[model samples]
Target: MQIEMKNIHKRFGANNVLTGVDFELLPGEVHALMGENGAGKSTLMNILTGLHQHDEGVIKINGEERSFSSPKQAEEGGIAFIHQELNIWPDMTVLENLFIGRERRNAFGLLKTKEMKELAREQFEKLSVLIPLEKEAGLCSVGQQQMIEIAKALMTNAEVIIMDEPTAALTEREISTLFEVIRSLSKQGVSIVYISHRMEEIFTICDRITVMRDGKTVDTKRIKETNFNEVVRKMVGRELEDRFPARNPSPGETVLEVRDFTRKGAFENISFSVKEGEIVGISGLMGAGRTEVMRAIFGLDSIDRGELYIHDQKTVIHTPNEAVRKGIGFITEDRKDEGLILDFSIRENIALPSVKSFAPKGLIDEKNEQQFVDMLIKRLTIKTESAETSAKNLSGGNQQKVVLAKWIGIGPKVLILDEPTRGVDVGAKREIYSLMNELTDRGMAIIMVSSELPEVLGMSDRILVFHEGKISGELTKEEATQEKIMTFAAGGQ
Candidate 1:
């Protein structure tokens, strides 16, 4: 399959998304789409896949001009799109979710359950997935869910597959397996359109790359012909200084501590302490209990047996409200579902935690609220027209910033961040790191749970590795390295 998009123009009211963009894909080649969060990468792909119509453009497939009316039409034309957000039905079984819309049936219209199982098993075996067909889809971990989405796309036997942020939720081992699968598919004459913000993966797996910046195609070059710095410079339209900011630690007394924390089947014997003016990083593979521990600490889940201490005093928190009142702020991993209300304005989401502070006498104070929200917006460098803009209207990086701003408004002594930089662009990531440094300088302790090793090493004062629900190893900032952390994470001494 060969696809060519030329002189594409898209507009939504007054906002122009894609302007005069050109992209091409050849059979049996992996093409990369690189850009910042709102650079129109996804928008261009959406136009190609028929999710949105381009106001002006020409689409040609195999030298024949074509325009698809819907995603189903595009799929029927041998194109499949695996979105960044997994579209899984939680209540349905794994098999059911996989073959939801395109189920096989007999001549009498009877469901072919046996045939579907065999087909699904074939795809799962090819990908080295061990999920049960009868298991509920919601029971799967995020990494497992990612694998499920990949397998679903492969089952379609698509000639051209568009994968957006496919590795964002996967672990190192899972990513290796996925790369192997992609290589095999390419060898079988399948073309792939890979979209990701991770420069390493883009250079490693893609044969050719297309860079987009601010609704325009900046350049397209062979992967071997370009370097990381050049690619980033093209994406952001400027020279980026550093991937991470400098951290100068000034440790104070312990602000939060947990002893013998045990959650059966989740994590066990988790003992750690975070001090004021410090950053403690938790590193582990997916499903290794990194996120479970944080959830329990924030009172979102139950702990069978544990002890929590705040400022050298025994504390008991049974709910999130109590945890907030106790001076602990939590930034959840799923920002769309748990962190913010999508339909609400940015001001509403930012002011949610500290609403009572502005309304002391059971009446709202609009002036004080506006000033407070406006300050954080400017401080975080969130790119929005105004605080009145809906959170869903902003890009992924800006939404993550709003989540951070919401937590900062509460003024918690200890803030817990889970995957703070996941799916964020390089430029926004540096800004978030700078903000983290500023917070620590102001005597706020942070406990960050991250899957990315470089981030853990770059921002942490101390590191703790988790393996099978236990603290496998602990290392100081000077002692930590990628090899040592991976060894601990893999349960080696």
Candidate 2:
């Protein structure tokens, strides 16, 4: 079966999320959608899945126009979508979740629990997904839960399966397993819609690729015809000036030093140091305690015992405010929950961290506040109509930039960024890379935590591999090979 969407147009209020976007998914082919955040990839998928109605479009399944008013209609048409945020009942067992809506009834008209369990196990095996059949869905790793969601799509025998950012939280081994499963599905004549930000995975799995920008179709091309640089150019519509700038550390003794930092059960024995104007990247699995170490550094979490020295001065940081005063800044993974107040305007959010800095005679200086916010936004290239716009209305990438702007406004010497580009699109990623290089060049000691291997490899001056919250080994940029990083990250100790 072939799925074709022609002239897809969708709008919300004054913003057109998808405009005249045309796409297609051939039978047994993995078609990938590439775009910046807010480019409407998810919107188009939603329309195909009948979760949202399109203003104008012709959807053809096997050359016949089809209309879907709800997910049931789409499912009946052999289309299944697994969103980035999995839609599953965490409290329910896997068997119950698999047969919730399509329950088997007994001959006497009662529930058929035995049949559901048998069917769920069959589905898991068929999809090569490892999930406890009777366990609660909430008690699963991010990758396992993702696999379960994909398995559910398979249980329906979907002709077209759409996956959005399927490997965002998956480990390297899990990603390999998923890629194999996708290939098997393609071999078995299932068309796949793969949406992801990782370019390496795109090249590894996708046969055809389509790039979208600003809700408009860029072009669709064969995988062999496109390159990473070309795809990045199309994503941002401009060349990035520089990604990693020269690292010239002032080296005024040791600015910060960690001695045998340990977080039991999560990670242990982490020891490292960062001088002024140095950027250190921690590379590892999603739970490698890189973020946890940063949390402990910023005094967000309690550490059993660890020595922290800032500017050659021993310090005990038990609160974020103390960390802030000690010239340390932390950017969280979930920008919405920990970074910014979505309801507030960008100006207000940036001022929230160090609003007192702009105070004159104990009264907040409105002019200075605006000046501080404006400087960060301009430097960060935050895409917004105005600073007055609510941060919630911005794109995911832009929202991340706002978070950066909020923290950068404080002028911290030791800045920590955790998964800074997690849910961001390619274009904004380029911009973030640009800002990081520029900021580091201007003498800001930095610590970056990233799950993406390429990013850590490309941007870090030195790479520290973490295994269960401990530093397995440290590698300089010249020595930080992806394979080496992976080895140390996967229990190299």
Candidate 3:
């Protein structure tokens, strides 16, 4: 399949999403769509997939002008899109999700369960995925869900697959397997449109690259002809100084501590502490109990046995409300589900945690709330039309900033951040790191749980590695390296 989209222009209520964008995909080639958040990468793809109609454009597939009316039509035409957000029916079984809309049937219109299972198994086997067909989709881990989505796409036998942020929730091993599958698919004459903010993966797996800036196609070049710095410069339309900001540590007394924290079958004996003006990074592979530990600390999950201390005083927090009252803020890893209310305005989400402070006499104060929300939005450099915009309308990086803003509004002494910059762009990532530095400088302790090793190494004053529900090793910033962190994360001595 060959796809050529020329001079695509799309607008939604005065928001010009895609402007004169040109994107092309060749058969058996992996093409990367690189951009900062809201750069119209997804918008252009949506137009191509028939999710949204372009106001002005010419779409040609295999030298024939074509326009799909729906995603189903696009898929039937040998094009499949695996969205950034997994579209899984939690209540349904794995097999049901795989063949939801396009189930096979017999001549009598009877369901072909056996045939569907066999087909799903074949696709999963090809991709090295080991998930049970009868298992509930919601019970699967994020990585498993991602694999399920990939397998579902493959089952369509799509000639052109658009994968957006496919590895955001996957582990290193899972990513390796996914890359292998992508390579195999490419070898089989399948073209892939890979959309991701991870520069390493883009350069590693993609054959060609198309850079977009502010809803415009900046450039398209062969992957071999372009470098990381050049791609980033094109995406952000400026010369980025550093991937991470410089850190200068100034230690203080302990602010929060967890002693012998244990959650059966999750994590155990997790003893750690964060001092005033310190950033403690927890590094581990997926399902290594890093998120579980943080959830327990924030009272989102219960611990079978543990001790939590605030300012050297033993504290018992049975719920999130109690944790918040104790001056602890938590920014969950799954921001869409846990951090913000998607339907609510940005002002509402940002002011939710601190609403009581603004309302002194049991009455809501709109003016103060708006001012507070506006300040954080500006301080965090959140790009939005206004505070009235819905949380779901913003881009991924902006949504992340909103999550951070929500937590920051609470004025907590200790903050817990899990996968803070999972799907964020390079420019926003640096801004988040700078914000972290500023927070620590103001005597706010932070506990960051991250899977990205460079981020852990760059921002952490101390790093703790988790393996098999235990703290395998701890290292200072001066001594920590990628190899050492991986070794400890893999349960090394």
Candidate 4:
């Protein structure tokens, strides 16, 4: 399969997202689409997949000029899209999701569950994907769900697969497996459109790279001919000397502390402290209770036994509001789901945390609210048309900035960030890191829970490794290494 998109142009009102962008995908090759957030990667892919109609473009598939009216049309044309967010019905079993809308039936119209399960198993085996066909899709791990999505695409006999950030939520082991699957598929003459912000993956797996910036296709090069710095320069239109900002100031007195925190079946004996002007990173494996401990501290989950102290004073927090009032803010992992209301305007979401401040005597001060949101937008460098724009309309990085703005508006003394840079572009990641540095310089304490080891090591003043619901070890900035962190995360002494 070969896909050629030439001179693609798309516009949303006055914002032209894709301006004459050209792309090509060759059979038996993994072609990477590289760009920063809102650089028109999604828009171009959406146009290719028929989710959005391009204002002007020429699409050729297999040497035939094609126009697709809907996603089903694109699928029927042998193009399948596996979005970053897996499109799986949580209540449905793997077998059911695999054969949806194309279920096999007997002459009496009875569903052929046995046949479907058998076929699903074959697909999984071919990809070396280990997942139970009987298990509910929602209950599966993120890595498993990603594999199921691929299996489902295989069921469609797709010749071209478009994967958007497929490895974002996967473990290193799972990522290795996925790369193997991609190689196998390429060997079988399948074309892949691999999109991601992780530069390492692009260099490791992609055969060719297309860089887009400001809605234009900058250049496409063979993977071997390009280096990381060149690709990043093309994507962001600037040279970023460092991926993380340097933290220089010494940490102040302890601002937040947890003593012997225990959550039955989730985490136990978790003890850590964050000093004013310090970044204390929590590192661990997926089920190692890093997130659970933070949730407990934020009062989002009940703690079976523990003690929390704010500014060295014992505190009791029964809910998120209580925690917030006590100067604690939590920026959750999934910004779209838990952090922000997508339908709400940026102004509304930013003002949600500080509603009381903007509203005196049960009435909103429109003037003050607008001023606050505008200041955050400018301060955070959020890219949006206006404060009236819906939160969902912003790019991934901008939406994250909005979440940060919300918490910042609350004037919290202690901020807990979970996967702060997850799914954000490298440029935005640097900006967020710089913002963290600025906040810490101003005497704010940040506790970051991150799966990215490089981020943990680069930005943290100290790291606390978690293993099996307990604190495995702690390392200072001068001592922390990826090997040591992994050792502690795996429960090694």
The digit string of per-residue lDDT tens for model 2 on 213-235 reads 98988999999999888887887
**Tens digits of per-residue lDDT for model 3, 1-493:** 9999999999999888888999999999999998999898888998899999999989999999999999999999999999887899999999999999999999999999999999999988877888999999999988899999999999898999999999999988889999999999999999999999889899899999999999999999999998989998998889898898898879799999999999899999999999999999999888899998988888889999989999999999989999999999999888887888999999999999999999999998889898999999999999988999999999888999999999999999999999999889998898899999999999999999998888998899999999999999999999999999999989897
TM-score of each: 0.98, 0.88, 0.98, 0.96
Residue pairs in candidate 4 whose N, alpha carbon or C atoms collide under 3 angstroms: none
Q: Per-residue lDDT tens digits of candidate 4, residues 1-493? A: 9889999999999999988999999999999998888999988888888899999989998899987888899899889999876788999988888888889999999998888888888988887777888889888866678788878887898899999988877766668878998898899999999999888899999999999998999999999999989988888899999888778967899999899999889998888789999999999887788888888888899998889999889999889999999999999987867899999999999999999997778999999999999999999889988999999888887899999999999889999999898778989899899999999999999999998899999999999999899899999989999999999988997
For each candidate in the order shown, give its overall lDDT on alpha carbons. Answer: 0.93, 0.84, 0.93, 0.89
Of the pair 1 and 2, which is ahead by TM-score? 1
Q: After superposition, how far is residue 365 of candidate 4 from its true place, in Å?
A: 0.4
Q: Give the per-residue lDDT of model 1 (tens digit) for 153-207.
A: 9988899999999998999999999999999999999999999888889989999
Which scores better on lDDT, 3 or 4?
A: 3
User: What is the Cα-based TM-score of model 4?
Assistant: 0.96
Which residue pairs show collisions in model 1?
Answer: none
Which of the two, 2 or 3, has more TM-score? 3
Better candidate number, 2 or 4, judged by lDDT: 4
Model 3 segments more than 4 A misplaced: none
